[model samples]
Target: MRITQGFTFEAAHFLPHVPETHRCRRMHGHSYRVELTLEGPVDPVTGFVVDFFDLEAAFAPLLQRLDHHCLNEVEGLENPTAELIAIWIWDRVKPAMPMLAVVKVYETAMSFAEYSGG
Candidate 1:
């Protein structure tokens, strides 16, 4: 079985190398959604794959970095595409939660990317 939790943050970004007329070239923002999924045998003590609160804490630092800031200015994300952002988040939180199975980052209601692996 798997358990998943969702969180949202707003951040701005621009594709610096894109032509000026490109829609994504200008600075803009998205109501970003981050979904973390944990897969494994559930922990008997809590009867959960992972505690939601613990997951929240694990992602807190990453949330701070992405919340209300320009993604381009965030360290290590000079070109914060959705796929890169998902990987960046996975790198930060995976060490803390060894059972973490995947990270899904949504740039829009219909657009998203996922990353997983050790």
Candidate 2:
């Protein structure tokens, strides 16, 4: 079974590695959405893979760091593409959420990326 929780934050970033003429080269902000998916068997006792509150607690600190901040200034997010952002969140949250199976990042309503560890 898989249980997923979503979070949103607003931050600005510019893709430095993209071509100078690329539109993304200029700074812009996104109401970024990240979803954490935890995969495991549902426990007979709890009837759920994991408690939603536990997931929220594990992610709150990272949310604070990412919200209203420049993604390029975040320690591991200097390049900050949707793909890299997914990887960055997975790296920070996985230890606290061992069951985490995927980190999905939405740069826009229609564009997103997913990372499942390696």
Estimate the overall C-alpha local distance difference test score of candidate 1: 0.91
Instruction: For model 2, state the Cα shift of residue 109 in Å.
Output: 0.7
What's the CA error at residue 36 for candidate 2, in Å? 0.4
When summed lDDT is taken over every stretch of 10 residues in candidate 1, the lowest stretch is 42-51
Compose the digit string of candidate 2's lDDT tens values, residues 1-118. Answer: 9999999999999999999999999999999999999999999998989999999999999999999999999998999999999988898899999999999999999999999998
Off by over 4 Å in 1: none
Count steric clashes of candidate 2.
Answer: 0
Error of 2 at 77 (Å): 0.9
RMSD of 2: 0.7
Error of 1 at 91 (Å): 0.4
- Tell me how far the alpha carbon of residue 115 in candidate 1 is from the true structure, in angstroms, after superposition: 1.3
Residues 1-118, model 1: lDDT tens digits = 8889999999999988778899999899999999999888977898988889999999998899999999999998999999889989888888998888999999999999988863
